[model samples]
Target: DQQVKQNSPSLSVQEGRISILNCDYTNSMFDYFLWYKKYPAEGPTFLISISSIKDKNEDGRFTVFLNKSAKHLSLHIVPSQPGDSAVYFCAAPYNNNDMRFGAGTRLTVKP
Candidate 1:
């Protein structure tokens, strides 16, 4: 089964706090990992990615960590702003042609 699960459908945080989103995969063959952020009615934008060969990747306020051995990954947003409120998707592909995605986690940051 090709299921990437985001158990929490949504998360809420106050401004200037750290927001964390978790992801899990059942397939062991997955070799690449990506995190995408989306605003309504638009395609997702790539936030951060980590190859299976690495354990962590970071960009500005965003950070992604992968634990291949445990089949888990997480995205962390530091001092999350209201602008960061959106849906986040975890994606992966074993062959690089098609990527499986989590249902998505919607984050809300209060002002």
Candidate 2:
């Protein structure tokens, strides 16, 4: 079974607005959450990450929020720019060598 899911396959937002990408997981053992952004021909790059012990983590224009009780996490990008357009994936690590990822959501930021 798929442990993590991104219900929306795509999202669109205007420049300077907020873009929200959501993810849900079924496994309760996951203690770390990570977000990755991928371009068409490049490998996914780590965007942000959060620990289960924290509800929110922010780095400049990007922020990751976690709700352990709901097994949900979201990535928020403020002042969304055209350069930020990419596919976003949410992931959870069950162990050092094992990680589960959500089918990414493609985000489009229009100028």
| Top candidate when judged by lDDT against the true structure | 2
- In model 2, how large is the Cα lDDT of residue 21? 98
CA lDDT scores, all candidates in order: 0.92, 0.96
Worst 10 residues of 2 by lDDT: 91-100
lDDT of 2 at 1: 89
lDDT of 2 by residue, 2-50 (tens): 8999999999999999999999999999999999999999999999999
Tens-digit lDDT string for candidate 1 (1-111): 647999999999999999999999999988888899999999999888888888888889998999988999999999899999999999988575888999999999999
Off by over 4 Å in 2: none
lDDT of 2: 0.96
Best TM-score among the predictions, by candidate number = 2
Model 1, runs deviating above 4 Å: none
